[model samples]
Target chain A: MAEKLLNWDEVLIGGTIKDPGNSKQYETGSWRVERPVWNPDTCIQCMFCWVYCPDSAIKVDENGKMAGIDYTFCKGCGICVEQCPSKPKSLKMILESQAKGKTEEELRKEVFSSEK
Target chain B: MGKKVALTGNEAAAHAIRQINPDVIAAFPITPSTPIPQTVAQFIADGEMDTELVTVESEHSAMSACIGAAAAGGRVMTATSANGYALMWEMLYIASGMRLPIVMAVVARALSSPLNIHGDHSDIMGGRDTGWIQLISENSQEAYDNIIQAVKIAENKNVMTPALVAQDGFNTSHTIEIWELEEDKKVKEFIGEYQPLYPMLNTDEPVTHGAWAPPNWYFEHKMNQLRGLLDAKDVVEKVGKEFGDVFGRHYGLYETYKLDDAEYVIVAAGSVCGTTKDVIDTLRENGVKAGLLKIRLFRPFPYKELADTLQSAKAIAVLDRVSPAGAQGGPLFTEIRSALYDTQTRAPIVNYTYGLGGRDTQPRHINSVFETLKRIVETGKVEKQFDCLNLRGEWR
Candidate 1:
């Protein structure tokens, strides 16, 4: 007996069984993770996370301790998490939910208050 | 009688162009945007559109041809996406700088590598720094109408900068929708004929175009370009009002949905905003005080309007489709922050990254974003950054 072969064209275009993950299904650059988080316990202080972070979100303290990731500049790629060599992995990916909420009016007040 | 026609946003744009009856159509095919020129060519071949369809070798040449045709006092149009947009970068600046009223359809596509051709804001986001007037369309209908309005807005004596009407590729560009096609005579009356400021091909009025400016006068020439773009804000408002009066469809620089008495909001552009609106409606039904801010005009960014609209919210989530690799922020996020800098309106505006490289952004995901915004408003702390929605990990 011959084994059955799956036709990609039929699967993709025939619409019989649609792969939602199909590359042609959507436009490019639609899924972007913006920031990467770091954990001190799993960090070896190897600095790979700092070196690999495209946005330079990873910072090292004066004492050489891996300070913290700056959410402002981070694009959440989890590259630092992927690059961490520690056994438990010191770096992690944090979703956009981790930041604080500041209303535009609140921000404006802060700006004016600071200026005063 | 209004007849419904199922067409992709690109096809709808092509249909709209057919009604416009432009003298010249120059373009280079690029993913998600290729269908536009292809459909336009079909229209031309079928004699539906009496126009010179020039297929250029590159996106750069496409705009160059558009400039040439428009300068020669011909109504011109073109389309490009993603890397093609990046390639046309210098010309984008030149088109606006020269104050040539060229109308371009920019099918929003992601910038390259791990190269993808789906939909994303990277292309138009990259062009934001250019002086062109940018309009983001949420659906096929807006894509059709804005391209028509783009011609009017750009050609207006008060606003001579080229215009970029942007639509998400694959998402909006390829998605089928039933849309109403405006009457040709109505569109003609609405847009009017192209009247050239300086017809380069004219023998009677010999004049030099794109001439090199000496250092002594270079600043003045640049200043004129800046002044024209600044003047365009009023022109955009006026044209938008006129268009609405004629077509019964009105648009503002930015549109607010469900914002009345809302404590939290989500701001975004393109088709995703439609999803956000649905989510906002769901949230409202559930008694969540949430709203949506849809950004339509991206270039002149409508800074004052954005600051005012978002002022009352306790928290706002600013969603961007493009990630700035080295900047630690999405380009639009940065711009929004800067726009709010001096205003008395401050909202803890959280930056959410989603729908990059053509990722699916569903209504449920948008609902979750509003949920997150509500949580941020209540708790006073946000994770700062969040990926609104994403696909399950694939076994590659």
Candidate 2:
């Protein structure tokens, strides 16, 4: 969501941000030219992507198993794909336009059909 | 009433600093201003003042440390001159932009290429656009008084802008003059306590200062800072008046000497104004209606008040102590001309570049300027709109 812009008088003096930990409010996904797609069917959850992601955009389930990638804060740096240790990589870097509006199963089929 | 004492300009500044006893002072020593920090350090060493003294390695680090300390909710100050001031050029903007309200005493000196260490306006004039309120002092007494008033002015909630009180290097900084030194208790009471706004040290209410403001926010923050600075003209007057009410030495946006019904006037600042006043007195005794408009609050330039004050003069000569550096005229010349632009004052204004690199300006030179103003008034024409005063071998 776009934050409301403040006029000169209403803005905080000296660019002071009163709210701490407010970087969460700024989404970095819009800056991404490439997106990271994940595959959970590799049957290994080394959590290496979670550990390597610079933006902390990786998500995990309650049982401490890798759930998926959180695209909202991902800047598409592809550090996770580079660090993926699986023989058939569970993460792949693809154009953001190619992944847009596509379901995960359809994307998995389209991206992995030519992989094997 | 304050007690009378003899002290140099640098000592006056140090005395004021000791009285204020700010929370922290980070400074790197430079010429003409070195004695200020030196004296303050002695005060601290002798247990006369308990302010934290941070002796930084360079002017850049000095200003950086000052900024850090000020953001941590401490009343901070420092002093520098010439190259040391030039070194802190970048941080000067940061201190004001963050609304740190750090007060500094600037013993104005020449910025060197040929390495002259004498007094001039090059240093302070270089900082005119750095968003700090500039209070120029005519002597050690004014320097002492301005430093005290600068604290209240900069720290005022309506202003929250850093201020630099400048006195001419060597000319005032080294000259001993008899002036009244107010009691420390009165000065402290006048400045009051420091109630910092949004201090970063307050863990209960964490605040981020100097935060990144991208394109969507940078303009507003800059405008806000400007508003605070522009609003400081009033705060300066108020504080100066309050200081006078308590201490008996009243100050204003600018000082006027025999300006009423004057046909000729000289607009100037710093210690040179003292010489000009002497010339004005001499000219007045000779049946010349000569006056002086001595600038005190330089930044926020007080365009309206200055214009109003200068409206009655028949002719005016503005003396700038720094090089124009390729500009049409010096900074003070440009500002005064612009200030008179919108007013009904059609007085013939002239610009003179003088005292550069600490060249001595004599009473005869000032008398020559007034004589030229008198000539302009009589003839209704100015032969040289821009000229150098007392230059060798004639400068047209």
Candidate 3:
């Protein structure tokens, strides 16, 4: 998004995308109507949501542990939520309006802290 | 100079395609143009050319396959006519928009309604707005020469737009004429190699084609496309001159016969230009200062050059082989009128919609057009702004 928009002469001819993996700049997360909030308290790191996420939005750390979700590219399709196997469900989809104005830490604390 | 050989327009197109021997050709047979792919297939069978022929089920798939091959960085081509051309209408814009530099031969024919298949401009006229550079041929010789020139014009680094070389259906496609057929080696050397702009198959430096362009970028992309299309005028002239330099046949944006000092002139395209030329010759023998302006390039329509060439004529008539549909005048007519609108040419211009649905236009019909032009010049008025020629029933 920091890259300046190109003029007609400056752009590549034929609408060809010369920059590979440039979709990372597109921020498809803005299309989401609902946000998936993740809870580490549920304690199961089966990585089912990671395997099922169509957008590959599920973030994994160096030890291969599920860290959290990357919202920049997530379309909130909820496939990850559907794929969650934990009984208390470590992953849950909430209305974007419900999650708005709250950080991931705040939303996770509010949704999972009381259950714990 | 090339050797003289006899061929029909379709055969000439096929021979030119064989000479080019492109990397890929995807086509589905239709009337008039069916022989083009068929001849190319025969050439492949005989090993005369090593081009890959992708025989698709329909025109849509034919064009789709052509696009795929072209995007994959291969020199590509195809042929179709009438409804088959109508079928490929959607992909036409995509081919040009993507700047693929594909070439096609269209054996121009009439579109259907009462179900007729014969020579007419209805099909090519319908596609005038599709953004592909258009070349209309007067006979088998121009058909052969134009096809060879088209490859260079389309694949020019500056103008990577798809191009279509058109000749009249039964009139030119089926009729035989002697034309200069260049040696294959010379023809190949003339077209040279096609360097694709952004080939999708370059694995080392991969690229994505046909990506979705949102509002923010769509306008810029379209403007970029227009840049290429408009820039084609210079490339077309440059390539034409080069082709003439290499071979003996020279071409230009348009060809004019006795246009310099003529007071009454007729502007037209396609095989009809030949007949019009004969009529002009006869009028000249009778001491009438009549001439003809035959359009070779229909797209990127050399409006300024045309208006300049036609500025001195006292009266002008535009002969269009297609119906106006609902417009007040035919496509070529309106374009010519518009071109002269800003010029000092005060000539009274008129439109003639003729030869629709394969209706044969005789010399008498063309002679009548000139007579009308002469009358308009003599009387200082246009009796009919738009009229039909050689129609069986009176067209008011």
| Best by the TM-score measure | 3
DockQ of 2: 0.72
Candidates 1 onward: DockQ, in order? 0.01, 0.72, 0.72
Candidate with the larger lDDT of 1 and 3 = 3
Range of the 10 consecutive residues with the lowest summed lDDT in candidate 1 chain B: B387-396
Ten-residue region with minimum lDDT total, candidate 3 chain B: B1-10
Best by lDDT: 2
User: Per-residue CA lDDT of candidate 2, range A1-116, in tens?
Assistant: 56889999999877888898888998988899998788777738999999999998999899998888888899999999999999789888999899889997888778877666
For model 1, the superposed segments whose C-alpha errors exceed 4 Å read A1-116, B385-388, B391-396
Off by over 4 Å in 3: A36-54, A61-68, A78-94, A101-116
What is candidate 1's TM-score against the reference? 0.75
Taking every candidate in turn, the Cα RMSD to the unseen true structure, in Å, is: 25.8, 3.2, 2.8
Supply the global lDDT for candidate 2: 0.93
Better of 1 and 2 by TM-score: 2
Query: On DockQ, who's better, 1 or 3?
Result: 3
Tens-place lDDT per residue, model 1, A44-111, is 88888888977666767998768876654555677887878876665545444442375433433443
State model 3's lDDT: 0.91
All candidates' TM-scores?
0.75, 0.90, 0.92
Q: What's chain A's TM-score in each predicted model?
A: 0.50, 0.83, 0.82
